[model samples]
Structures are given as structure tokens and as C-alpha cells.
Target: MAVLTLVLLLAGLVLGALTAGAAPDKQAIVGSALGLEGKLGAAIAKAPAGAGAGQIDSSAPRGFLGIPGAPQVNPILAFLWAVWVGWIFSTVGAFGGIMAGVGHMTIFGLGDYAKSFKKTAPELNKVLTDCIRMANQWLVGLSSAISSLNYLRSKRLAWPLGLALGAGSLFGAVVIPIMTGGKISFSQYQGWFGVAVFVVGGFLLYETTPKGQAGKKAAKAAAQAFEKSVKEGGESAQGIAVKKWGLTRIEFSFFGVEFGFNPFWAFIGGVLIAAISSFLGVGGGFLYVPYLTSIVGLPMFVVAGTSALAVLLSMVTSIASYLNFAGAAVDWALIGVELVGIFIGSMVGPRTQKYIPDIWLKRLFVVLALYVGLGYFSKGFFGQSWVPM
Candidate 1:
């Protein structure tokens, strides 16, 4: 699977690079887009009931369409976008949405342009949001699967944990999305998401502070000891191995250290994580990593792969739900542009992670979560992000 993902990534890179060399000129784009508009307008004019802008409205996104005066994006920029998303996902098993949002915002200011666009073409915004969600979810799911292949080959993933989490994710991502049917607006989602994750981020950040020095010191010492053992030619043996898998609970050993968790609670966590992720268009790894490490008492070494597996499963179900229930329409042109780069980035993240210490990775995760979580919270609660539409 790993080899397959790598081969696909390389092939895509070569083909995309070649195609980008002959990008269309600005006049051509205007002609094509306007031509499309003409066709759509004409088709609507001939409709039996009534034909107008309301019936055939288009909220087409700029910058991504290679239109005149739009942000110019070729395979290179798209590839880099994928690489960025993949690196974040592979390293921490999440952050794909935030990176993609930042990438899209480059075309225009995030809330400012969106608010204006939605004001003019209200219904079209719903379809556009759904399409973007589908594309981003697909990217996350594929990247996570690619990253998990190597971990699976090396037996680093805890299958029991994955199964439990995946089951819950299916419920959270698929069934729940279908039930809601896009009733939640973007700002409403943002506000709720901010309030929920703010607490998690704050708690994790505090754990790294001086007041929580005991845990930090212990984690750092363990990491240093493991590094020294490896340097002295002795196997540090920091890997997860399943000891017991059962109906209600499962137990595992990490680097000769044992831990147990209730499968039911993990499943419940998976449900909550997937519910939020399906709405937010993320892989839910940020939530999963913290849950596994802090709440479940699992070592950080095993959390990446486990979280990735869970994310992959959730994305699979969530994607189906979005298309089926949310009426999402994917932008294939944009997706093709980024898939190759994301694959490369995701594949490299796990392989290179060995050089970094476990304590450092956890620290990185906490800091990112705090920063991102607070940004979401502040914007949702106090900023102008919530456009009451």
C-alpha cells in the first residue's frame, strides 16, 4: 500500500508538471468561464417553469478557476498546498482543514469575501461549501490511508483500538451528518467548535506549563533515556504490541509498558470526534491524539498511527455521508491539483518522525492545539466570524 501511494504520487507529479507547462492564458479563461455562464443562462432561460439568475445562479470560486484577475494557481502551487496539508496530517494525524482553509483564503480574505459572495448568491453558497467539504475530506482520508500503510506494515497500529474508534466514527461521521442535513451554518459550526475545543486545548497547554512540571519532566526523561539506549547500540523497543483484544475493552503494551482502555469509551470519543470533524472538514486527529495520550494514558509513540487509522475510517464514512446527505459536489480540478503533493507529504511524515523525540512531538501537538483552538474560540465568540445568516 505504501509503495502504491508513493508510485501514484510520483506519477501525478510528473503528469501535473507537464500539464501545467501549457496553462491557459487569461483571455482563454474569461472566454471559457463566460461561455459556461452563457450556456447555463441559456439553459435556464428555456426552463419550463421560470428561468432567471435565481434558478441558474453560480457562486463559482475565483483564484482556483485560473480566471482572469484571479489568483494564479498552477500544479506547482496546488502541489505545495497538498504537501503542506500532508505534512500537517502525517506529523500529527490532523490539521488538514486549517491548512486548506489558509490556502483558499489566499485567493481572498476568509470571512470578508465569503460574506459578500454569500450575500449576493445565498443558496449557491450552500452548494459551494458542500463541494469544498467533499474535496477536503477526500484529501484527508487519502493522505491518512497512505500514511497508515507503513505503520500497518511495521505493526505499529493497535488494531483493537482502531476497530473501536472506527466503529464510533462511522456513527458520528455518517449517520449524524445525514440526520442534520446541513442545518448547521458555517458560523454556528465555528462558534460551537471553538467553545468545545478551547477547553481541550487549554487543558493540554497547561499540562506543559511549570505547574505541570512533574509530568513534563518524567516524559522528557523517558525520551532521553530511550534516545541514549538507541545510541548505545541497544534496541529501545518503543513500539505498541497488542496483549488482549475483547468485546468491552482492550489492553496493549508500548515499549514494554502496559496500558488498558475501555473500548466503549473510546468509541464514544470517536463518535464525538467524528461528529465535529464531519462538520469542520478535518481528520479529527487533533482530538484523537490528545484523547489517546492524555485521557487514555497511551504513549505518544503509538498515538500517531492509531489516530491515523481512526481518522482514515472516519473520513471514509464522513465522505459518503457528505455526498449522500449534504449534497456535496466535489471540484475535481482542484482535487487533482493537490492529491500528488499531499501523498508525498503524508508518506514522508511517519518515516521521518523517528528522529524526533516523543516528548517534543507531544509538546508540538499541545502548542498547535492551543494556538489553533484559541483562534477558533476567540473568533467565534468575540470576533466577526459569525455572520448570522
Candidate 2:
């Protein structure tokens, strides 16, 4: 089923790219439909540049879109690239997923088993569970912090950024497993890393505030005052109450599948995930996992599985957007190398999860979070160029 979905998604992207230019004014029409005006309209008015801008020519390849001046790679080559990249990402995602799952199982499942089995060493089970829970949260938080810093410093925060970051992280996750031969230690750096990430993220946020922008302090203050007033008003009284008690949720449907999202807050959560995911190079699964667990009151297991599932949707949308607009050529050989690395990493990642103690897991997560945060903060404060590859 997963394979079929991926195939269909790729096909749709190719078709969309080929036919993007069928109507020269399609983007204009779309902008008008969306009720955009002026500069916004102009921004949206541009079609996918390059080969995505030409008319469909039958004389071209059967599935080809006649994009003028577009660099066209052979279909066979593109297919191979897709396969390689897809496999690589899948492997990375799978490995992360498996490790996360094991951590969760340790926390909840093992604890349950200890009670049910009436084991002589049941107390050890509780300690292990706690460690895993802590590690999971810490790692997630660290990743989030890093992602946030990256986003704040970036001139442009787009979905492609997130995709690339995801790709990179996937590579890292897979590589670590291979280098260690599945004996990667979560204990060595989880907690400190998380602290570093948080620090970096906080610094980036501080540096990017409107106060830091030239001559914007007064305006920023005024805006904040206005917002505060609105929040304190009678109209906002009920709204605030509702916010406190209400379940904040976001629902969207794609490819005939209905997905639900919520985590303490809606807009902030969405923006954070979108921005950070783009910046950090992972599908934002780490952030989502924590949010779902801490705020939405979901089980750790559910969060891990659901986040992994959501990534597939994100990847498809990203690939489709790239194909439809940029029409970049895929490098199949390079993609193949990535895939091999990913597959090996994913298969081995889960095994490590089973061995790590829960307390240690939590500490590891914290360390990673801190590291990411610090990295971002430094970039923002120092004006360092921290571009993702």
C-alpha cells in the first residue's frame, strides 16, 4: 500500500509538471481565485519557472511537459533517482521510527509487562521506563529548539527547506547506526544536547524580535499593547476562557485520508512545526512526537507511529511541489547511495532502542535538544551562515 501511494504521488507530480504550462495564465487565475491582490498576486502569478512554463507538445516524450529551457533528465533516470531518494528517506524515517517506538515500548509496554508477569526484578522495569520517557522528551525538545533557531535566522522559511533538512537528518540518523554497528549510545549526549538546543533556539528568537529590527521598537511595542488590550477586553474574556478549556485541533484531509492535529495550541504549534521542520532537516516528527505526548495527551506509542505516518504525506507534497515548479533533474546514482545508507541504518536503529534504559533515553533527548538550540542561537547572535546542505 505504501509503495502504491508513493508511485501514484510521483506520477501525479510528473503530470502536474508537464501540464503546468497548459494555460499560460493559470497562476494568474489561481491568484485571483485565492483573492490575493497586488504584490501577493504578483508573487503567486509566476508559474513554475523553466520547463514548467511551456505548452504541452505531443512530439515530446509521451509523459513530458514541454517546459522551455528546462533541464530534462531521462524518465528512466528520474525514476531511478526517485527510487533512491525515496528508499533513503524511508530507511532513515523507519530507523528513527523504530528507535522511538522502542523507547516508547520500554516506557509503557515494559512497565505493563513487569506488572503482569510479576517478575522478581519488577522495580528495574519502572526505572527503565522513566529513563526512556525522559530521554524521548529531551531529544524531541532538542530537535525542536534547533529547528526553531534555523528558521528564525533564515531569510526564507519554505517547505523545501524542511524537506532538505529532513533528508539530512535522515542521513545522520542512518549513518550513526551504521558507524556504531547498532550500538549507538543514547546516554552519551542526550540531556546536554537538549539543553544546548534550547539555548540556541531562545537566542535566535531573542535576536529576531522586532526590537532587533531597525527603527521598529516603537511599532513593535504599540502592536504588543494593542494585542494585550484585545486580550483583556470583554470580548476576549470568553475567548480566553474557551482557549483555556477548549480542545485546540486542526484537521485536514489529503489523498482521501483524514488527519487530526492539536497540541495545547493550534496556530503556534503548526507554525513552529512547519518552520522548525524545514530548518532542522527532519520531517518535524521529533517535535510532533513530543507535542502529541505532552500537550495532546496521546500515548507515546501513538505519537511515534502517527508522526511517522504524517511524514509520508509531507514528503509527497514536497516532491510534488518541486516537480510541478522547479523541474530539477534527479541524480539517480547519488540517490542510490543515500538509499543504501538509509536501509542499513533503519534496520539497525530499532535494535538499539530495545537496549537503552528509559532514564538514559530522557537524558539523551535533553542533551540533543540543548545542542540544537545552542547551535541556532549562536548563528543568530553571531550572524553565522548555517545553511543546511
Q: Pick the candidate with the highest TM-score.
A: 1
lDDT of 2 by residue, 1-389 (tens): 99999999999999999898476663222222122232222322332222232222222342211212213434454334333333322333312422332323222232232222123222222222222323232333333343445433432222222233344434433332223211212222222333435643443344345544433576678988888888543432110011122245444332233334443343345445544332222345656566656775544433444444334433333333322332222333433443344355445555665676533544444444344444434333443314320
Q: Which tens-of-lDDT digit does each residue in 31-74 have in candidate 1?
A: 12333232222322232221222222233344433211223456
Clashing pairs in 1: none
Alpha-carbon shift of residue 290 in model 2 (angstroms): 1.5
Candidate 2 lowest-lDDT run of ten:
236-245
Error of 2 at 304 (Å): 5.0
After the best TM-score superposition of candidate 2, give how far the Cα of residue 94 lies from its true spot, in angstroms.
11
lDDT of 1: 0.62
Best-fitting candidate, scored by lDDT: 1
RMSD of 2: 26.7
